[model samples]
Target: MPVIDQLRDSLGWDVVLTDDADRDARSHDTWPVATVWAKLGRHPHRPDAVVRASSVEDVVTTLRIAAQTGTPVTAWGLGSSVTGQPLPVAGGIVLDLAGLVSEPVLDEIDRTVTVAAGVRGSDLESWLGERGLTLNHSPQSLGRSTVGGWIATRATGQFSSRYGGIEDLVVGYQVVLADGTVADLGQRPRAAMGPDLKQLFLGSEGTLGVVTRVTCKVFAHPEHRVVEAFTLPDVEAGLTAMRQISQCGLRPFLVRFYDRDEAAHAVPHEEISAPVLFLGHEGLTSVATAEHAAATAIVASLGGTSMGAAPVDAWLSRRYDFSTVENLLAEPGGYAETVEVANVWSRLAPMYAELKQTLAPLATEVLGHFSHVYDQGSSLYMILLGRADDDETALARLEEIWARAMKVVVAHDGEISHHHGGGLARQPWVRESLGTGYPVLQKLKDGLDPAGLLNPGKLGFGRR
Candidate 1:
């Protein structure tokens, strides 16, 4: 019998799936053509077998088996990723991280917590809330995406403008390597070591190892929060307002800009004559009040029209419900897709315009929104919808749209991906993004995963 067959007998039929139907279902993450029409040009590859690992031992055993058989290994989280990062191209074992749901341990004295890889963001937040603490990370996919996957992808949450991304929150990690070696990065409050090795697996996307547990910094639950919304004359005006607010040094937890179409899609036939910007502040009562005052003053100075708090509250309520994308995709003659691009403060306006102009013709409807603000600039999330004969055609159209948009971004000097890692979808642009140092990245991949057993064909380094 094959190794997988023997392993199936040892691990039980319920844990190991070899059926074609089961394999097909487990092989691919949710990469329907409608969801990627504005991002890539091809259908995602599905893995050969998906091993639903229930414990660290299972993960170690699975990796050991793959190493012995020269099979590739990829980790799967919640399948919420737009990039084909979790897709299995080499037809090997997928170490599904969903099965490892261990509860987090909060150390009130240290003001820190240890979380399992499988804990979803929203669940973790609620769990911590019961103990007078909270995980501030609130990505759009918070309800479904796992902590391990978030750290693996270096996800930026809605509050990244204030709280920072997963990279900032992560302090330590427990990882399982390709050869089944367990490595524990220090769990101390601070380390004076030569290098922070935890960062290696933080954004590794399973190329280096599997993250089983994580220790992240947490904050006390805010005593007060204020939400505000405004309308700017145009995308450029919105950008200006955002830049002014950032320069003012009042960091709002949520700062979002929706272009004309995105504003319409998000707010519906509301009489907004301009782009919409939403701001949220959270902290102690006094801090929240001060932040709100500062934010409102900046918006007023920039000719923004205040729309009260309803819109901001609505966004907060439904921030994690991306299931709507799937519903939109299921519509007849309807499709849904999103592409995110980041550029310098100066290039944001032009990049936004160029992206809209490039994708407008190909899409029946094109909407753009900006979030994940930084000191330098912000990232644009472009949502596109259209009609297509099949997933392949839709994906092809997306590839064309991204090609044009990427060209404009590169010409104007911007990074290809901000929060989203380069799965197989963005491999073509990796060289351009890395420039002269691209070879160094390949060398690192070669050194760490000599057998190329980890997430092969993704991140633009490994052999296909």
Candidate 2:
């Protein structure tokens, strides 16, 4: 029998979609490059067929068929990616995993929750809310993203400074390898097991395997919460205060410090011309209240000007808004993109200054914010805006902006990406970023998926 015939017989054709409409719908994700390509009457690779995976068995079946057919398989979640991670550049079968969900089981004793990877972020949060527990993993894409996508991309929540990112939340997961083998990685909270295997798949972006289920740590609802706002004279001052706060052992769940231009975008109706900072804490009443006071003192000692919680509340009320990017793309002669990079404290400031200054000429406006901080340093997110008359000019300007920014970051010894993973957007730089490690990563990829059927072309893996 033909391979296509075997697939048609193994998984009922009802679960398979090969028509033009389904292929078109599965073509692109939220990758800004997709938007540009669409406007140009072109598109990235679209899968030849889409398999609606309703269960782990379905995924296993698909992989078995892929192994025999040498068909590229790119797992699809809610498709909320901005990094073009889900683009099916391999032109084979796209496994849609958004519909496979099971009820979340809360292990109250262990303070962990086990859930199917298909669960949406908002849905999981609501289920936990009924049980008086919270995941504390609230990324801006919460409503549109899935647990598997979060784990696959190694995503970070907005309150990552305290609650931690997906990597920190994930205890273990069930992955289906390229050969249809099921691997259950990790067991105990902390294991001295040889060669921790879970970390390899955390940010693998489906290039390693398909995550079917995930078990992650959870937290009790905070008994006390406080949100405070301040304005620094400039970003340099704000950066200093943040470093101090992180180093001083004060835990602020959210530490969002935006430059002047970004502040204007954060609150359009108000006048926020200077760099702004928002600090928020939520935990035990005793711990939170005392820490809030201590944090205030520390900020005051650093000459921070208190602006009350009004600004903080305003930002909290609309933290997940993506209107800026949406509206900009909708308008003609308008272009904008956001790039995030990270480095040690010693190199962060210099890299930030270099990239910001270097891209200023090409961009009409450049805005930045430092969030998801660590004791050593922090992640810097740069949002840039530019304009050109046509798609050709616009694309050239956009590519130039990314190139200039990436060169500066690489020169400063910063990782090209912090959490978004090395998808198509960062594939070009993965080799340079990894240095000697690229060969090791390639060896790992070859050993796992020799056919190169899983998310091929991403992360500098096999070309699609």
Candidate 3:
């Protein structure tokens, strides 16, 4: 029997799919290059089959068969990854884990929730909100992305300044290794035990194993909320204000500072002639008020003109709108992409300036904004849009742009990726970015996935 037939025999016929539509849909994720390929009706890496595993046993059986047959099995969430992490490059089996949904179990006393990997972020948040709770993790792709995808990519949310990224929110997970072994790790709040093994799969991009379920921290919905916006004379001043606020231990829950160009695009007002900064605070009424006041004082001291709550409110209203990038990518001969990188505060200003200057000639527009602030530094998103004469030229230009951006990032001693895990888009620089850590990753891959079948050729792992 063929592999698909065998999967059906073991896991049910409905669970196995070999249709062209299913294979095509799993070929590429939301990666810009992949988007371009999609626009041109091309799916270069479609899997030979798709297995919609609805239960852990289904996953175990599929992996066991794949391992026995020397087949590649790449896990799929909602295909929201922008880095091509879910592309079935090796063309064996695409395990569709989205069907593995489980009713979330909330631990009111522990302040955490155990949810299946297929749970959509927005759905989970809505479910928690009904009970006066929240996951407090809202990535831009929250509506479409899954909790498993979040864990796999090491995702961060907009409210990360106060609540932290997915890594901080995740308390434990249940995963299935490459050879059909199911491992449940990190069941406690904290442990002095061996290296938190759950971390190995946190950002592994499904190269190490498949994340089936997650137990993550949850917060009661904020009792009060405050939004503050400021006009900074320059990006440098805005960065300084953010650092001071963070270092002062005032958690705003949301901190976004846009460069001049991005500010104009974001605010879209002739009066918006300077960089814009937006801060938000939430908690008990009194606590939110106090933090808002303190953050306002810091911004004022830095010569930040108070723009009041209007701008921030405007942003909050449409925070999840991704049509700008989507529409641009859909257009013929058009290209758009966003790259996020981070470093220490001292190097951020120079790095930002150098990146903008270096990328000026390559694209029609290069805009940036800073968010996910920490005491040490923050992530900067470089948004670029350009056009070419044709699809082939556009794809080539995208590669060139990434190559140039990575060089500038390395020169500035900055991380190549902050939240967007190294899908194929960043594969070329993963080794350089990981440095000595690269070989350690290789060892881990070898030890766990000795057959080199799980998500082959991603994150500088297995085959390239």
Specify the highest-TM-score model's number. 3
Q: Model 1, range 384-433, lDDT digits (tens) per residue?
A: 87877765666577677767777877887888888877776577788888
Which parts of model 3 have CA positions greater than 4 angstroms off? none
Clash pairs for candidate 3: none
Instruction: Tell me the TM-score of each prediction against the true structure.
Output: 0.93, 0.97, 0.98
Q: Write the per-residue lDDT of candidate 2 for residues 66-119, one digit (tens) a residue.
A: 998888999999888887898899788899999889999888899988888999
Ranking by TM-score: 3, 2, 1
Give the per-residue lDDT of model 3 (tens digit) for 126-210: 9999999989998989998999999899999998999898888999999999998999988477788888887889899999999
Worst lDDT 10-window in candidate 2: 1-10
lDDT of each: 0.79, 0.86, 0.90
Q: How accurate is candidate 1 locally (lDDT)?
A: 0.79
Selected candidate, larger lDDT, 1 vs 3: 3
- lDDT of candidate model 2 versus the reference: 0.86
